[model samples]
Target: MHPPSVRSERLVSPTGRGYLQLESHPAGCFRGVELMRAQVPAPDAPPARRPTALVIGSSAGYGLASTITGLVRYGIDGVGIGWERAAGQRSASAGWYRTIAAATIARDLRSNFVFRNADAFADSTKSETLDLLEERFGGVDYLIYSVAAPRRTDPRTGITHQSVLKPLGEPHTTRNLEFADDGTALLRDVTVEPATEAEKAATVRVMGGEDWSRWVTALAGRGLLRDGFRTVALSYIGSPLTSAIYRAGTIGAAKEHLESTAVTLDALLAGFGGRALVSVNGAVISQALTAVPGIPLYVCLLRGVLGDRFPSPVEQSLQLWEQLTADRPDVDERGRIRLDRWELSAAVQATMAERWRSVTPATLTELADVPWFRTQFRALYGFDVPGVDYAVPVATDLPWPGSPAR
Candidate 1:
């Protein structure tokens, strides 16, 4: 029988995606069923009228899901910007496969689609992306900024910044499960320390909306934005149990800035009827969120409330797009969309409260949806998807999404 555990290294930004395993379902599980359902767009969609868009930080999670939604659902003549590694001899990030799959589907449905594996925070990358938009599609009507990273090097200041997941003031004492190095559901509890003032500032520097503002201003100046262009970035505000580390922590500060920046950008975009809004999105399993300190165990606890019923990134993105496209889009008083309404509903919170009181290491496996959670986790990497034969040889080296000249 196939072993439950497989040796795998933790992926980090510095080394890129070379160490990623592409073999059996144990490697990444590209053969899962949910992935196929999400990737396959609704058929026979109406034609797009030269609709163009530019998406930043669009490799995985809500960003990648939004990319698929943009191409498949809206049939936008879209270009995606993300930092990704090529599907080399033995490895590639899940985003690479997702981009390929989405781009192929877009083409099949006669939707124009392209992607670039370049840093979105860099000025040079943005310039290159602008050129692609000019060459392929005259201008973009939508700018989707969904970047989530652990670190960012500021081009202007020449300062390297790293993000942290620690609480604001005091150390947040809670149960956390560190996964086994062999890539299994196996876990052990550990406590995370609080972050220093410097670390919090650094986290804000990397995760804040400053980079997002730069892109909007640059594009607006270059006349690359179409009339009524709308840009949205994702954020999260969930239960208070994880507040100390997530919502009220350094990342939360960053998200607050992100939301405020939207207000400023809205003014900047008013001239062209273009609007910028921050969508307080739900917690979805993705590369960046998975890497957060307290989020894993929080998700496991959340499983007790929302099991297989929990929404996927694709679902979240699609709902967001639909709401924004509606005749009267739903938005909060601050002019921001709340796509996470379901996650923070009264009923959900009630369940969360009940579960948090009784859940423990002993009852966690039984009370929580471990199998369902594991499957969802594996699905992020495009693994364990039904109908995908893991034993068969996969054509890893698909056509590159970059190459602005193309």
Candidate 2:
């Protein structure tokens, strides 16, 4: 009899290969976790002082990559703040498992890793972060804000704000994709509805920079932010194919607010010789990208357009982290950091625009790489890592970060 093979949790099955056979159990997934670990670039020589970095939303995506890179590269002690769901009867979110792997790796590397599993927007969580930093790492010099959420509740007024990914004023039609129940990808044109004024405000509230400002302000007020601080908040500016729904949409307004708040933080941190920067990352297929409507199709087209030049979330984070820590980075005229150079380059954008304009439903299959897009989508959920032995059982209840060691 043959051994049981692990089944993919993907919505669709690949007609081919190049994707990790996802295991629901975390223990069976260590190979992929370690794969991410191996990619973090280490520095030639460690820093003179043991620096501390406080990364908000540090469980998965860019935040997770940033924290892991800092630990491996600069030998920085870190405090990661996240609001991830705990593992339930079956399995937890990928972020939860990634947190487990991150904590374990940090301990193995002998780096101080403090995990804060709470809502970053809440005042109580801020207080807790401040208290923990005071008790453990003393004060943090690098503050990385990478929180991306669908909704947020105002702690002061108890009002819940949710974000939408529609156009700003009028409806816009765009070519997009939808997956069949059996996982067959189909191309279609979607007319995204416009956002109302209230919806726009709500989007800003949920995904904007107000909360980021509060964090820096509170940290500075409490002396939690050390001198010579550098705080970064990650944002995106994609191709014109997604410009309407992504760049000029309601989320765009939120990102504008976020960039504006970076300026605010920059001015505020200047009092202590600190700086605040907003890094414009490329159009990555991160969790946030997956959440936005109409992005999947663009990604599939982009994959075809920028063959062999696309960078994954891990690659983007490693590049940004290295530039920020070690080398002089490229910045735009507004003093904002520019990490999307490759994405927004003249050649790439021109080709993307030409292909986007020429793309059609009948030609989409030939023009886009559907299988690769599916692989990336599955990889986001920790489903598609290479060289993992799926036959073994993986632990689900790893000690929750910030819990007492038993």
Off by over 4 Å in 1: 1-48, 87-90, 181-187, 395-399, 402-406
**1-406 in candidate 1: lDDT tens per residue?**
1112223333321122312334322223323323543654673657547578788866677777777777767777778877766544444566765665556556666767777878887889888888878887878888888888889999998788999888877767765544444534544544678889999889888888999999998888788888888888888887777787788988998998899999999999989987898888887766676666656766777776776677777777888887656656689998889988877889887877777667776777766666666556666665645565456434444445433211
RMSD of each candidate? 5.5, 4.7
**Candidate 1: worst-modelled 10 consecutive residues by lDDT:** 1-10
The most accurate candidate by TM-score is 2
lDDT of 2 by residue, 253-300 (tens): 999999998888889888887888898987766767865666787788
TM-score of each: 0.87, 0.90
| Clashes found in each candidate (C-alpha, N, C closer than 3 A) | 12, 2
RMSD of 2: 4.7
Clashes of 2: 2
Give the distance in Å from residue 374's predicted Cα in candidate 2 to where it truly belongs: 0.7
Q: Cα lDDT of model 1 overall?
A: 0.71
Worst 10 residues of 2 by lDDT: 1-10
